[model samples]
Each structure stands twice: as C-alpha cells, then as structure tokens.
Target: MPSAAGTLDWLPLADHLDLVAAPVASAAALVPRARVARIDAGLADTAAFCAAYDVAPGASANCVVVAGRRGGATTYAAVLVLATTRADVNGVVRTELDARKCSFAAHDDAVGLTGMEFGGITPVGLPEGWPVLVDEAVVAAGDVVVGSGLRSSKLLLPAADLLRLPGARALALSRPA
Candidate 1:
C-alpha cells in the first residue's frame, strides 16, 4: 500500500474512489465480474509492473499517453493496448490527434494530465479534456486491469468499461505494433 512518494499512508481502491472527481461505477456497468486485487510492488515501469504483479504479458494491458495536434492545436490523449503489442501512436494516433507531428507526452506531463502516477495509469478516471484511444484487442478481451484513480492499486474491470470511459472508443486508432 506504499505510494511512489514513499508515504506510509495506504488506501484501498474503494476508499480512493471518493477522492476522485470522476465517475465511480463498477465494471459490471460494461462487462462481467472480474477479479480485482491490491498490488504492493512498484509499477513504475512495464517490465517491473508485469514482474511484480505476475501479470502475463499477453493478458496485460498498457495505457500510454500520446501528444499530437487536434483541431489545429496541440493536444494529448491516452491510448490503451495489450502488453503483448505496442500502441500504434505514430500511425492512427497521430491522425487522431490531428497533428503533423505527434509523440508520447513527457513523463511528468503524462502523470500530471492524467492525475495518476506513472505505471498505474489506466484509461479510466482521466481528466475530461483528454481523449482515450482503446485498442481493439482490449475490447475483445473479456476483462482487463485499469487504474483505480491511484498509483498503488488497480481495478480489474470489463474491457467494455474501457469503452465507457470518456473518449475510449475510436475506430482504427489501433493497429499491430
């Protein structure tokens, strides 16, 4: 239950939901029941997350932030993909952001924008302004793990809930990486 800041305070996902300004509905609103657990290891990096959580690479989902141009202005969006495959940021995400140039947002920027610590970031509970791009593979999955509005824990929810997250669905935004 330790935090990235090395604080002793630890709260469960259920407890932190009240602290979030966004929605707190269950994954059943979109998909079926799935297992949820609290993680104690640091998920600051993909390899570390997978190893610490014992998450199968093929069964895991990765959420990333992509910066691009939208409506002739620079913008950023979150993209979700299976851990087994990389996000197609430069291809579809570039066009989605409507930018001639696009790339991953800086680490600090991504964490600040999403309001969640790195490695624990999921498509859900993001600020309203940021769009979410979901890979089709994720949607096909029955269940997935996402952020619980905190960095120390993750929620196992239906992939369909990912679609329910604001701006989560946008066709052709993903491709084999």
Candidate 2:
C-alpha cells in the first residue's frame, strides 16, 4: 500500500466509513487497497485540496460527469483525467459514447444522478452501465488522490486498481490542461 504524504493521516476505507459518502461507504468492500482521509470540506476542490495538502497536481485525478445525447437518448459517463490535463469531452468522449453531442453534465444533474457531491464524485460507486472512461495517463500514475464521493474526504489508491471497477475502460481520453 502507498503511504500518505504531507499532513494527512490516511486510514483504511473499510474502517473509516463515516468519512465518506453513502455510496462510497457501501462500496468499501470493492476497494481493499484504498485509504481515505478527512479534509476540510472547503478545500475539496482540486486546486485547493492539492495546495492545502502539499500534493502534486499531476498526482491527483479528477472525475467528471459527462452527458451525451443522440436522437432522443441520453447517456451518462464518468471521465477521469489527471489534474494536469482535461478530458477530451467534445471529440474523444463524444465518439466513444456514440453521441452526436457531449458536454459536462449540469451540476444538479450530476449530483442528483450520482448521489455524490459536485466536487467529490468518484468513479468507484457510479451507477451501473455508466461507462468509466479513464485517461491512459491516469492508469499510468501508480498512486494518486481522488474524491471520496464527499467533499469532506478523499481517496488514495493505486491508479491501476481503478480498472477493476465496473464499466472501466483505459483510453487516451485527455489533453493538456
């Protein structure tokens, strides 16, 4: 297991359920290697969290919700990219989701549909059938910090482990920020 750096005290997620969101807590069984750390909710946003925790921006990953529409059907997906890059939402993502249009999901829709806070929507417990589009760079990053489905906590684990999550797919899905 990777050790936590900076000022945070990381604890096994299974033993620290109260710090995470309901969905993340319920999914703890699926993440034996992950550790969770409580943080000031006010710093949950990526940039603030990284700076406050003394973490490198490239070693943090962000999960974004995308809404893709084609005809009368709409599809939702999770797009994960390193903090140093941005998801190719209009090009790669639209093509991958097989939608005529794709963009970041509305804030309310993302929170309502995923049952997670706007800035803390991790990919671990996403709804079934929602594709998890992981950027290849994220997969290559051995260990990284990610949201814990709540603004008050964060998750730390080997990036490669994300592939075990349901609907996960590795692809070149990001461009430089």
Candidate 3:
C-alpha cells in the first residue's frame, strides 16, 4: 500500500478474513490488489474514519443499500459514492432499479439480508445478481477507502477495481449533499 494511505498498515485483504464479514472475505480474496486494515469500531463511519485516518473525503467512498419495491416484488442494490457527495437515492437510484418507490433499506433489512454489520456494509460480496451502482466519480478515483463489512476494519483498493465485481455499473449516481 502507498505511504499516503493514512496510518493504516494495509495488507492483503484475503489474509485477514476474520476481520471482515463472511461474504466480504469470500469475495475479496479474488481481488488481488485489495488490502485491509484494522481500525477502532467507533471510527467505522465515513466521517470519523476519514478524520482519524487522515483520508481525504474524495478518496473515501460509502456503500449504501437501497430497496425498490413495486407491488409485492422488491429489488435490492448497493450504491457506492464518494463521501464528498451523496447517492441520488430518490432519483437516479429509484429509476435505475425500475421501481415505483425506493428508499434506504431498513437497518435490520440491510444487515440481515447482507449478513454485514449496520455501518460496515460494502458493495463487495453482495448477494448475487444485485446491481452495484458505482458513482462515475468513484470509479475514476485511483485509490479509495471502503467498508469491510465489519466496523473494526476497512478495505483499500483502486476504486476502479470495484467494476470487476459482478453486476457493477458506472453511472452518475450522486450529487453534492
């Protein structure tokens, strides 16, 4: 990892599966360039993590789970956007999912469905077939910090690498908030 990567001693994400959620560990192992590091659970949120770690907001991304429901069918997807902005959830995201209404997934629903902690859910390792809506700016960012599916750890990798995961699509997904 680069020395500019704040204070975290990033190492191969695959070697520290125990520090991440189960699904993250499984999917991360395939991304050879990805790295992981431990952090105080209290600093898991984007603002705290960036402040304490000296990471730029532009270099940090947040993953949010959104639910789109129409009739009795519901679709879930993960949205990734730079911390400097916010996902256009009610606009682009809802249209992207092709649902009549959309909103942030309920806390219990997000955690239970993904098997990841509330503040640590990541776009990586999501259930199969769920689209990972990555903001265009995020993919263009060379290096970015992301959740590890565990509040105690974080993932570091080229933001573009996120596109390698299944069902990833680069779009104008966010705007300054």
Candidate 4:
C-alpha cells in the first residue's frame, strides 16, 4: 500500500511486529484478514502519525485506556474511538463500566498493564478481562488504522474485526470533538 512516505510494505499483522506486541499479532490473526505497516516511531501519536503516513483522521482509530473504581475495586477498559471524535469517558464509558467515576488511565499504569507504548496502545492486545469498548462509529468506519502496541508499527483491519476481539463490545462511547 502507498503512503505519504512512499510505498508502504504492508505485511501480515503477525510478521515484523515487536515481541512486546505479540498479543496484538495473536489477536489480529483471529480476524479473517489483517495487515500491518512499519512507520517512524517518532510519529506514533495520532496527528503526527496520520500526517506523516498520509492517512485520513477518520480512518485512524485511537485506543485509550480508562480507569475507575466501584465498590472499592478498580476497573479498567480500553476504549476505541476514531481520531475525529473523543471518547465519552465520564459519561457513556463510566456508565458502561458501572463506575462511579472514570478517567484516562495514568501513563505508567497503562503502559505497565498493556506493555504498549504510551501512544500505541491497541485493543487487540489488552489485559485479560479488560473490556474493549469500541465506539459504534469506529466499527462502521470500514478498515481503520490502529497502533501495533509498539510505537514502531500500526495495524490495518476492518472495523468489524475489532469487535470480534475477545472482550470487545460496541457502544455509544464517543462524541464528536
């Protein structure tokens, strides 16, 4: 596939991915079809990544980790939303998680739990039992781009394929920015 930087060497998601992102590769394999591409690690953040790679914002998905507490127990979830919108962390997400209050997970915690870089967490390789709450719009966006758990690559797959991930579920979890 071609990108702003020239031709993108799209490969199976399982190949040429970092070992830390193995879970993402494993989950991606479960999908009927998935592809990945290497990119400059410095451009891993959404805006830079899209611009540097010639990807439309709408075609890029961002996965954010949220955390909250209820009944003295902490709960966490990975929320997937398009770059064009913002995840409703305090509203729909909190309600869905049955949390009294919710907020984006701290940098260290998110990286520690998922073993993914700060700007490269993806729903594909989240901790077991953590909900992968995808915004409804994301699933309807056709094939979308997402982080590869490491900052060195990104995955491309149908939005619906994300919903098929082990703990993934679609919800009205985002609002336009």
lDDT of 3 by residue, 1-177 (tens): 322278888988877788889999889755678889999999999888888888888888899999999999999999999998999999999999999999999999999999999999998899999999999999988888989999999999998899998999999988997
lDDT of each: 0.63, 0.90, 0.89, 0.83
Q: Which ten residues in a row have the lowest lDDT in candidate 3?
A: 1-10
Ranking by TM-score: 2, 3, 4, 1
Candidate 2 lDDT at 92 equals 96
lDDT of 1 by residue, 5-75 (tens): 12223334444454322333232233234333555636635566556656555546788888896556778
Listed per model in order, the count of residue pairs whose N, CA or C atoms clash below 3 Å is 1, 0, 0, 0
lDDT of 3 at 113: 92
Each model's Cα RMSD: 6.4, 2.1, 1.9, 2.5
Prediction 3 TM-score vs. true:
0.96
- RMSD of candidate 3 to the truth, in angstroms, is 1.9
Per-residue accuracy of model 4 over 13-74 as CA lDDT, tens digit each: 55554533867766665665777788888988988888777887888889999997897989
Q: Candidate 1: which stretches are off by over 4 Å?
A: 1-36, 70-72, 170-177
Give the total clashing residue pairs for model 1. Answer: 1
Q: What's the CA error at residue 123 for candidate 2, in Å? A: 0.3
Name the regions of candidate 4 deviating beyond 4 angstroms: 1-7, 18-20
Model 1: weakest 10-residue lDDT segment is 1-10
